[model samples]
Target chain A: MIVLSSVSKWYPNGARPALIDVSVEIGAGEFVFLVGPSGSGKSTLLRLLLREERATSGQVVVAGRDVARIADRRVPQLRRIVGCVFQDFRLLPNRTVAANVAFALDVVGRPRHVVRSVVPEVLELVGLGEKADRYPDELSGGEQQRVAIARAFVGRPRVLLADEPTGNLDPATSIEIMSLLDAVHRAGTTVIMATHNASLVDAMRRRVLELGDGALIRDEADGRYDQTVPQPLSPSATLPPVVPPPLVMLPPAVPAPRGVPAPTALPARPAGQAPDAERSPWATPTRSGPVG
Target chain B: MGDTDAQWPGRLMRPGPLASLLWTGLRRNLAMTGAVIVTVTICLAMLGAGLLLRAQVHTIDGFLLDQIEVVVDLSDGITPAERSALEAEMRRDPLIAGVRYETKKQVYERFRRDFRGSPDVVAGVGPEDLPAALRLTLADPRASRDIAVTYTGLDGVEAVRDQRALLDPLYRFLDAFTVGAFTLAAVQALASFALIYTMIRISAHARRRETAIMKLVGASNATIRAPFVLESAVAGLAGGLLVAGVLVAAKVFLVDGKFARQTMFPLFGWAAVWESAVVVLAAGVLAAAVMASIALRRHLRV
Candidate 1:
């Protein structure tokens, strides 16, 4: 769960703020699509949630903790609960697929047995169990993204943020990657994916939060990619219909494996209830009411 | 979940994975690692050699300073009373440690024995040709110049000579040599630090993707930096061991086997060698580790 009340981020020498007066809330077990053009603050919003960049003025709370105000030393602790994937599929070229996945756990100081046991299971979950010994260069683009997903999901994080994860893949490969993400979402991890793929966004029919020129333009439940573009004559007429692959069914609600500290699940906030301002000591006090 | 949370500190305490990471990093960058080790070894060798040479110079200085004395030669027409009075005067002087009088025959005989290899030169000299003098040893060798200047135009004195004057030029040359050695060592140390910095920067650049992934996966800054720092530390340790080997070999071969046997001057012993080696080792390791840390901090932000 995340809450951003009046979040505004500005680059020091920039002429305009990257994000301005944007406020949004995401509840637990929700899959949200962040749709925007380049420089529209989609990636910037995700970065704010990760605390990679501080909001100039805001209370960016993730799972009941104000991420912007957490100590620098505890940033890693926050990251352990919120995993991330990127468009480039940032895997170490020299490491094997299994080592690459295990690296995520290793950096968090997981024990050898846990890495040994959990890496294979996660790789299996991503359908890369047969290519465990293959290097990143040896894998196909979709497979590489699957490795990245397995690594992000291996930590059993509560929230997964992806920034254009399928940008580098073919349309068909992108669909497979989306299916993998859909399975991850089905397993109870909150997924906030930022993407430009209208077809996938339309096919998925999930909640859409659109940004334009650093402002939150729309928040729609079960929304299309764009309201301006006319809908197709038929839902599946313009492009190939997006569908989950038949073989890649992620085990439903996979429990936390040994050695990974299971994320403390926060209770989903009820609609119309105000966010608790007392928990965020560093938040600006100018606005107190919930954003409509 | 609570049990796993309680185990976090204990699990992090085990450096087993980190140690492997360090080893793998070193192995992956073998050429750079070897280059760093060689650089450190050469620099530390120069530093250790300079220190040992300074120690040897100090030892020889002490030995030679203790032998310093002033000689007062008597005039040809001086009476025995004049010679005895001059001897008594020197004995009573606070600066004079001891006074021995040599007669003309004794002086001539000693000159003959010193030039025994050159019989032709000895044949030209006679007992009456040499001057009788009082060899005046000083309480402090540094006072030789003052004593020589004091007795230069005294009664019954033909000329006064200070042995310290003869050795001053040699001491100056040795002092300059010591300073030159240390300066060269310092330059080499600077070069070593620069090489280490460059090596760490290159390694960090090469592993930037891996490091970025590590950071994304919640690795601490220390965790990301540990392998690079440990790689440099391993090279430093190797270089220090090589320096110790070089110093020990220098002591055994150059100091004891060659200089001690070939020259009458006293050379420093093993204790000095070990002390210099330890200092060089510490300096080499400390510099390498510090340079690596600085390079990582500047070039790689975890």
Candidate 2:
């Protein structure tokens, strides 16, 4: 789970804040899309979640620990729990496919036996098991991105962050990559992807959060690609409310074995009920009046 | 996944992931490896040469000091008591290594033996013509001037002479040469460090993609840094060993076998060469490691 409360970020010497009083909450096991135009703060939001940059005010929490309070030495522990993928598919050109996947495990000091077993499993998952000996340059663009995904998933992290995973791909390849991410999400990893592809976002029909000028303009359930007139609240029409159980919803919040507190539990409500309007003040109040 | 997780990397002295990374880095940056090795080798060789020259100068200084001494001649009509007093004072001096008193007859005999090559010259010199003298050897040859001044106007002394002035020009030349060699070596060592720093920066730039990947995959800062440091250190070690081989060869084949026999001044032995080689080897490894670390701290933040 990821939570940001009134988070604001301003770079030094910049005329304005990159992110302005942004508050968000994402539950576990849900795939969400972060859509924005160029320089509209999509990358800055992701960077803040990764703790690459600190929030100027308020709390930034991931998995239950307030990241702003995490010490520098413990930053690696947080990073190991979170997996990231880049737009350019950053793979070592000199290493083979198997070596690339194995590197993730090796650096964390996993046992040799574990690394030996995990590399082939992840490669096979990505359907590149036979090309384990081929260097990255030898592979096509789709295959290289697949390798990057395989590396990100090798450690079985709870959260995956992808920054424009298909920005450089053709339409067909982009569909294939999105399907792979969908498959990963189905298997219980919370996936958050940021992109500028409108058609893909429209086709996915997942939860969409739009940003313009560093503000959260719209957050929709089964949302679409483009913004339209805000639909009036249907007092009788309820939101889609199949909130998957929180990662640690077994009623024991004191495990502390995961090195942090158990994730904040989702609102306990029956299906087909309206989302707590009080918690989503921006979603309700802005729809009732002009959005600044 | 507790302490064992942290300890896993600490035991990586063998061919684990970090070791393989180091090997791969060395293989990929072949040109950089060669440059670092060559620079380190030149630096160490110059340093070793300076050390060898310093050793030779010390040996030559020892030989020259052994041959220089002070001689005090007695005046006419000197009493035996005064002569005995002078001999006792010279012998009691802490600075004097040894003192020998020669009578007029013994001096004449020594003169006859020294002039045997020219019998006519020996016949021309009588026993009365030779003055009785006291020859004093000082512990330090550089103190000869002080001794000469102290004894020149003594009650029973005719004159005091120092033979060390004849060797002044040779000592001056050796001192200048030793200082020059060390200065050159120091300059070359600094140049080698600059070259190593540049090489590390280039190598890091070339591998930026891999470094970014590593960081995304959650590799620690130490893990990212180990390969560069290890590669540079290995290059320095190889360079040091190469210079050691050159030093040993020069000592065994050139200096000991040829120069020592011709000049009759002993050159450095195998022990000295090996000692200098060890020192150079340590210096090379230390310098490379330090240079690589500094460059990485500045350039390779990930």
Model 1 stretches astray by more than 4 angstroms: A12-15, A63-65, A70-74, A170-176, A182-188, A198-205, A227-292, B1-7, B10-39, B62-165
Give me the chain B TM-score of candidate 2: 0.82
Fraction of real interface contacts that model 1 preserves: 0.42
By summed lDDT, which 10 consecutive residues of candidate 2 chain B come out lowest?
B1-10
Error of 1 at B280 (Å): 2.1
Work out the TM-score per prediction. Answer: 0.73, 0.78
* Candidate 2 Cα RMSD (Å): 11.4
- What are the root-mean-square deviations of the candidates from the true structure over C-alphas? 13.3, 11.4
What tens-digit string does per-residue lDDT give for candidate 2 at B1-302?
11112234432222588878777778877887898798789888888887877777777657656876788889877899999999899988877899988888988898899789999999888899978988888898888888988888999899897877676776687678877877877887787778778878777766666666666666777777778888888988999999999999889888977787787555666677878899989988988888889888887876
Window of ten residues with lowest summed lDDT in model 2 chain A: A231-240
Q: Give the lDDT of residue A120 in candidate 2.
A: 98
The digit string of per-residue lDDT tens for model 2 on A137-181 reads: 999898999999999988787788988999989889888889888
The CAPRI classification for model 2 reads as incorrect
User: Candidate 1: what lDDT?
Assistant: 0.78
